[model samples]
Target: MRQYLILLLLFTLVQSAVTDSPRRPNSNPPKGFVTTKGSKFVLDGKPFYFVGTNSYWVPLLTTKEDVESTFKQMKNAGVKVLRTWGFNAINGSELAAARNSDLTYYQVWNSTEWVLNDGPQGLQRLDNVIAMAGKYNIKIILTFTNNWVGYGGSELYVNWIGGAGSTHDVFYTHPKIIASYQRYVKTIVNRYKTSPNIFAWELMNEARCLGDLPGGPSCIPGSGTLYHWYNQQANFVRSLDPYHLITTGGEGHFYWKKPVGFWYNGQFISDYNFNGQAGEDFDRDLTLENIDFGTYHIYPQYWYPQLDTPGSNFTLKAWGIDWIKLHAKAAKRVGKPVILEEFGVTGLENKTDIYPAWVDSALSTGHGIMPWQFGALGLTENGGNRVIKYADALINGASPNDGHAFYENQTTVWNVFTNAAKVQDAKSK
Candidate 1:
């Protein structure tokens, strides 16, 4: 759904005991991390790039040892930021507090959710996580909900109970929904308004525009739902927190008309416009008045040449640099900061790794990127979409370096970021 920040700052006191050198992001965030209009942010004063990963879900209500490892890994890899989700279990405290009318994302088998209520713990919990993240010098592109709350898939609906009654997607028509969202935002912005580590406010991860559910056309707002959620979420975030950057972590918003929110109906450029080969890739003009940054989620599902069997040959794997370039260029052309939020060559057998040089080329533009994921804990016969073993190797219990994709020369993505940051720094002067 979105990328996660796999980083942890567990070695702070120990490091301080040995040496007083500060960390990259935490040591005192550079002025560049701040958001200012006209000259909002400059990588070394010039356009900068943000490279990071995503944690599919965060169990704010409960703690997990593995979660910390992911963030630690990203930081070790020099990943600057993390695209993370604000958890809200379909059946969590927030929804229980909502009691009945609200929707919480408790449908999935083994997914964690983080939602808030009218109490101090929820708000305090977020602040605590944010503070911990600050220790690693990691900024977060935080999303309010998950992808299980909408449609029949994984989305973060506030009151979703995931029953027959709650199967249908919840709409903004509910006042409680809007109020809950606002309350969460107010809590976050009011508390961290001055914090430099918070990167941006991602409205929702992969708000879809579906003509119908994967099965049929009975989905509410199926075709028309995309625009509804996009506009509403934009207005909602702006009304609550307008200071930082705002974006929807959709699959590919460069040309895809709608972003995450509805999960209604949509098609990749080629499939929808041109018969699966190539299409009229015009900018959808999605830069809503409230949005400051441009964002997209690219997982090779649509772009991969042999999508179904991309894993058949890692060499042929699709989540490569060329795809990032095309998508970034499209976003840049649209006049907004480009972000590759959800993407990774995450497959069981076909794990096609993105090499570093390819990363160097893609990040040459110095744009921000959040690699699709941080860890995939356990795969229950997944459709080869996620690789649990890789995530397992990427996770750990004590040490913090577990969540990073370690094979740099092999994977090459880690190098992509370092190389880009170097170039961006050189240009800053």
Candidate 2:
């Protein structure tokens, strides 16, 4: 009888352990400006959809007057949602040109102290942004950090913890750095927890555990580590901010294999290496319970094969459409909304139809879409390629007006985007 009791006790222990493990929880509040009902965004108890843009560099890179002008342009274009960076904390010399010491939302005063200032230079700028967004009735998706080195994100954390020249994974594992990150997170969340202008709190701009060094991109650690980091940070953020939604802010590059029904040409998957891009795991990360929504970016020129190749414009367009459907289906399966948060192409040629195509897909099946960037200013940082370069420009209060302006003579594209917004507004009403 004692032996039988021991066996039963073992079984009970096993069952209890399994039951105690956390599962992905759904993050749908009943009534709010940014709640979710299943896979649809519910604003004021009505289904909400948006056509948005990334004025990510505005908080620090542009002057207060420039911020007003740019947001005015966005409002005129009917951009309902504006995504911006909430965190830019990088110091030291290697990539100093893009380091804005004054504008960093969170600063490391010394090795052990992080000065999370809300004064003129720190969180006040974001405060001003939130106020500006409210003026135009625009909701904001504020991202915390970048995964890459340009803006002193994961690399900065790694260096601060004495892991200089190490991979970004260290930032997740290092006790001291993680503590510092938590402090920063608590500070920001507590500061803006009551603000209604924020639509969501993006955990990171693009959270990846890329083992990139100072020079270039290198290998990645085990893919599972990235997912674990996302889960931890996301849950932490949700715990702090009860009012706002949360998302991982991944580039929508899938780490999972193509689904059985999804059609893909060799060039589509091979030219850009989607699976390993930024070392992301979309299938796992997006479906997490605390993650209120899923986001992906579509940058064909940077990721797809050349137009002259066999992939061709038609194939490219088809792939883009399929990518949207695939992720939308994934979100639906998990009962969450998805957004094509970033999409763009460059050149003198007109690509007005590109935004419309993606926007249509998003509205009909998904939640919404945001163009790569919008605002009066051109890509002023890092020669207009990466947003991380905004840090350097902010520190020196310099605006490098590169030629990558999304608002320059963009009448056709703007009309398509705003037209969609008008439809969404009608539905909400």
Candidate 3:
């Protein structure tokens, strides 16, 4: 009788252990690393749906204290992921002539070779940003380069190899340029390959056939040039770091179909998004073996300025919702989770009125949403008096204000994000 009772107690405890734990049997990801299962993101064996935000200036900030404050404010608003620039290249000539010695840069191109800046005001700044994000329990998506010229993008590479007259698209196919990019990528990937705080390595920001400059004769859109480049770089990063996720960081343009039209306000416009002129095929790119998920951005005002006017046949709100639905449908077909990675409106009222509906659609469709940018309040000295202003407004001592930033001071817009984050958290369970 005594032996029977002891065996029965042991069996009950085993059952309870199996039932109470959230982890699935035979499923384990590296501690704190996020992995995907089917159409959902899995972290520690459970589905992980989240609300995140972007702040490209975080790594370029001058101090660790500022970085910590940025992460803390984001955590307070329920941001689980952050996206920032990982590459900042400058020509050695430009560096030598620059008036600001305090500026941060990751790579420099000399006459014969490329030099990586890993000291203070360089990669070390990125190191601090990552460390603070880890301390605050947030993950980061580091974008390797930009399609635009804001922070030394593909154009810079072309300049390094072909001088002033070279075309922008060669950055994708030029053998020497590709090798230089690979060298930089390998260095960054190996440095933090073991860190669990990295959510993904973004290949580039808004990659298109045309960048700050015109494309060459060979830079044909819908020609699979960008697609091939993405595949090569993604495979290279994976070889260096198998733990982190990868994404194209394109604006989610599609080339499979051509010239789809949509009503904007009162007039009909050909949807350039569906046209292959951007050298992006949303569906095709997501199908890449190493590409983990899909990402799309919504900025109706920028994409269709006509829609911003009153009395339109279709409203921006309606168009944005449809955009979300379309991408969600695509994710289902591809069998991977997709994120509405960056989106925003110009007005606070527009955001307050439209964001909730979009968030609801994202939640119902099992998609994650991250606003274009997150803003925080910070203090600075002005003539011996302390002044409070948006931290982003102080970047490089000037605001890049694309008019999409939202902050804690903006209670209504801020609530929409915070509440949606809570709802996403609840649904993840």
Candidate 4:
């Protein structure tokens, strides 16, 4: 069985089942709009940098009337950009409403995350987020998926959303599943192809469709469906929009260095067939240009001191530097600049937060870095009140302007990130 090769047609049918929202206005790149590689973003030929905690409060800073006020806060702090999350809770009551509905499965069980809802389920709320980002001159690295991968459970449901996976996602070799992916991607990209503020496409969040095992899977549609799945995805992003750049959210360690036959390289060479590329001398870039850019993730406690958080002091930022060098080298090897998409240090671990310094070293070396998060995760109000409390100081106090201080538990990483906010004056320009 050749297994569904009518790619373009199969994509069409899949969209009918998952289709929700009607088309909206989109922002296309202007004529001759070439995104040049610079220290920061180059919108229409200028320098830029997206710096800020993955801000949760910034989006809701001030009253509803001043939604853009958060971006201003970043600007005020001399921060140029904020790595904003997709779904955010507007009304706490909605959380209850979603739980009562059949929507929980669609949202990775995180009702507070608004991005998971498709169609009218969360259209208005999402629009406000996009509008707020635009109003503040903030460019977004909008991720379609969440950190649902490693958490397990219902994530399998999300993974199987369209055909074993969509056009690029070859989760399983299932017939209809692969077809469904093709359609799902076409629908989503066609709807948003022209959004100027949508900096790029992040197909999913930290996904590992293929298990971490040797001789597991590869680029070909075979034992390892993850590679084929990713190819379908990466290709879909390019075909539908053909404007904005795109990359996998973060497939974890494999994103950077994979085994000789790993899927990242295997999909093109065949993961199960490492020697398959030996005929071509295993040229690394065969599928390198298949994607627009490169992305990677890191777990410090796992890689560095191996000490559980608050106790470990793994300071290599090893992947960060290697990512820049490897991907940039790889990008140049294939003609693209690398993007350091996701990396996070647990704020819940041992009171010390080394992430800020970690990030500083990476970006100072001049790689595009999007730290894990902001808002309730790192710098949100504590002890539950309208008041905003940033984990800037271990002491836990109110922000300026008399905002109250509330905290869950203060980690050293929190204060370092808060302090680093001042160091990122580069974004303002």
Candidate 5:
């Protein structure tokens, strides 16, 4: 009897240890879901060097036909993956004042609490997008929220919980705010956790210490705060959905211990992007055990005007290429895949001149690339080709002529992506 009691105690201790052990990578991801395999994305036991595009308004459109048309155009262009907005937060007053009664929204803040919209004008819109994507054989990376104010983002949450004078960064640490965000996350993740078409779940779109509104007095300017928030949120997502991949939808800013300076035209800026001012440290963020891959964006025309000039020795093209190489190197160091998730240049001629070289760089470095947007061509009243736009991107009938969108009519620019997709597909096989 004494010997048996000792043996049972030992067995109980061993089981407890196993229960407390850290989670291992999902060795057997479900079929048709994307997973990482040592510095590359693998889908169904094959390398997935996907060339995709962003279409944030796909879920916000009022008509299912428009959604199908968008997916059809993307499929024809050889796009295998797409990154889009999976969040739409609004207050009741805003919804009431909307011009269209059929406006789509996912969550609504009703003065004191959040009411999730799972009806036809809410998450059902997203359901349509996922259904169409699966039908078209494309995967989706769904971003949970935005850092900007264009679509009720972090600021909206701040306003909701912290009230009138709250800072944007409070969305990261405040317990109430975090709980609310996670409630929405849990609802969405649980609803579609079994979907094979979900490529990944992004924590936020371009998460930063500051947003369109001010940071106020309580914001921290380093990587620690956001890092903590990322670990918390990412682990939560992983806990709920172990099969799908996860990523931080960041702009890939660095807060290096030994920061590197680069020459931008004639100026040597030491600490613009590399500094921790934005509270983003790409290297540090990627190191979190739950984070499966890394992502970075390139918008030299907007972020670094000095490099955007043509005829310069170090033009935007050169800088953008180097950026791709840098992130690829980091991905290798961390033993994970890194994607040049977004890149774009203004003007059709500039895009024609610059994007091919950037695409080639991403391919050479074994990194995936998605441009800022992909636009579809629609017929005007006179039967002329006009670009279909939605949400805040609507200007006349065209998408935000932010000059970054690659519309179907711009064949030269469109071909750059289609050809890259073909090359990527060939490499994957």
Candidate 6:
């Protein structure tokens, strides 16, 4: 009788442990989107598959009316997610224009420190975004910062804490900079901790240790350091809001071995050779327990500049397909869901063909994809990578002067988007 009682007690403890694991289903009623049973995402007790769009500029660029109209348009088109910017650190030069500049999102406190301005200038737009998201039944993945300087990213933080001309790695190591980031995370997480509209909190936007220029290559931090910083930041966010999911908005480019055979697994400082390959290791980063899912962004034209003709070595579409397959395989190895958070076509390429082919490959990954942006295809940025215009823009002849211009193949890509959403939704059902 005594032996049997001990056995029963052990069994109860084991079962409780299993149930208490973060990935395990909770006894409480399902509320928001969550990672369950490993790589699968569940919302309201059902599998959650999404067709999302990138509109990073929405919080800063669009007004309340424009935002409502935008979400209305997306809901009608069947888009389930909107990934937008959550942070906008003002550059020192941009402060003078903060009172009147349409782009400045924060007010400078002492020519160094910054704070969210009042009214429509700062995070009020984000508040409206969240409210609108709930109204439209759309989820939002809010990214903390950008890796580049275009929108006053890490440089802004580094400049404030470490002064200008500081290296990219300092943003991750500087004490003040890290604290500032933590403050931002805490502020936003606490603000929306109860809102079901938030799908996840992304650590940064395409975070790479790069040069001042948006796409220019620079010193890549050691893979271990990069992931460690990500882990720290992600864990901090989780501590603040344990209910929400977390992700690192890495570019998904793995760092390669330098000098032919270095056996570095990103554990020590030496693994990061400053003179060596500098980029994010998608597979390794996603392996962290703190990271709820994997994220990847591709610009085939930017990565593989050697675009081919009809039957050459490698076409842009083939490259895009290959990237998705490789990263999907990585995600499978890591047992995590991989999201193609951002991809776009160059203005010179025919998006009609590229978008469909990439979507098919993305769906094969058993997750989902979000193209570079939604809204309009405006003045090209970063070596021709442009947003895909809305279907209505193409059909209605919305020109650049009216805010955006439609590409010749924009309608075809939009069709791919709507059709893909329908098929994915059916599968989820």
Q: Which has the greatest TM-score?
A: 5
Each model's TM-score? 0.61, 0.79, 0.87, 0.59, 0.88, 0.79
Model 1 misplaced regions, further than 4 Å: 1-33, 36-40, 43-46, 56-73, 90-123, 149-180, 210-224, 253-282, 301-322, 347-353, 375-421, 424-429
| Candidates in descending lDDT order | 5, 3, 6, 2, 1, 4
Instruction: State the local distance difference test value for candidate 6.
Output: 0.68
Global lDDT scores for all candidate models: 0.47, 0.67, 0.80, 0.43, 0.81, 0.68
lDDT of 1 by residue, 39-138 (tens): 1244334544456666534333223233454455566666677776564443433344433322223222222233334233344445555766777877
Give the distance in Å from residue 204's predicted Cα in candidate 4 to where it truly belongs. Answer: 1.2
lDDT of candidate 2 over 1-429, digit per residue (tens):
999999999987764443333444334543435877888887876778778888666776434675676677788887888998878664534224433433444454345445555666666778888889889889999887777765446667776674546666677666687667777777778877777788998877766655354322333423466676677777677666656888888887666454322225443334233455556767777766678889988765655444535534455556677788888888888888888888766652435645567678878884777877663644334333343344323222233333233654666765777788887777676
Worst 10 residues of 5 by lDDT: 379-388
Better of 3 and 4 by lDDT: 3
> Which tens-of-lDDT digit does each residue in 59-148 have in candidate 3?
756666667777989999999999999898888877854326456688888853589899887899899998899999999988999999
Which residue ranges in model 2 land beyond 4 Å of their true spot? 1-32, 92-105, 108-113, 211-223, 257-278, 305-315, 348-350, 377-404
Candidate 5 on 1-429: residue-level lDDT in tens?
A: 999999999987774443323353588988898888889889889999989999887786666776787898899999998999888878778777442545578878876468988988888889999989999999999998999976567777888787877788889988889878888888989988899989999999998888877764554546388888888888778777878888999999888767666676477677657877788888899988778999999887788666546666668888888888889888899999988888888888789999999999999988888998988655122232223223354544444456688887888998999999999999898
Worst 10 residues of 2 by lDDT: 394-403
**Model 3 lDDT on a 0 to 1 scale:** 0.80
Which wins on TM-score, candidate 1 or candidate 4?
A: 1
- Candidate 6 shows a clash count of 0
Which one wins by TM-score: 5 or 6?
Answer: 5
Residues 163-257 of candidate 6 have per-residue lDDT tens digits of: 75677767777778887877777788888877889888899887766647332223443446677678778767766666777899887876555
Instruction: Kindly list the per-residue Cα lDDT of model 4 for residues 1-429, writing each as its tens digit.
Output: 345667756776675323322221123556322253522345565544445434433333323343444455544433434454443322234456444531212233323122344544343444565667667666666555443432122133334443233322233344554454344455456655676666666665555433321122343322334444455556656656656766655533332224443222235332322233111111232243344555555554444443233533324354345544544454455454455555554434422434555566655644555555433322233322343222322112222221222122343554554455545444425
Q: Which residue runs of candidate 4 sit more than 4 Å off their true CA positions?
A: 1-28, 31-34, 38-41, 52-72, 78-121, 146-175, 210-227, 251-287, 302-332, 347-353, 376-429
All candidates in order of TM-score, best leading: 5, 3, 6, 2, 1, 4
Model 5 superposed RMSD (Cα): 6.0
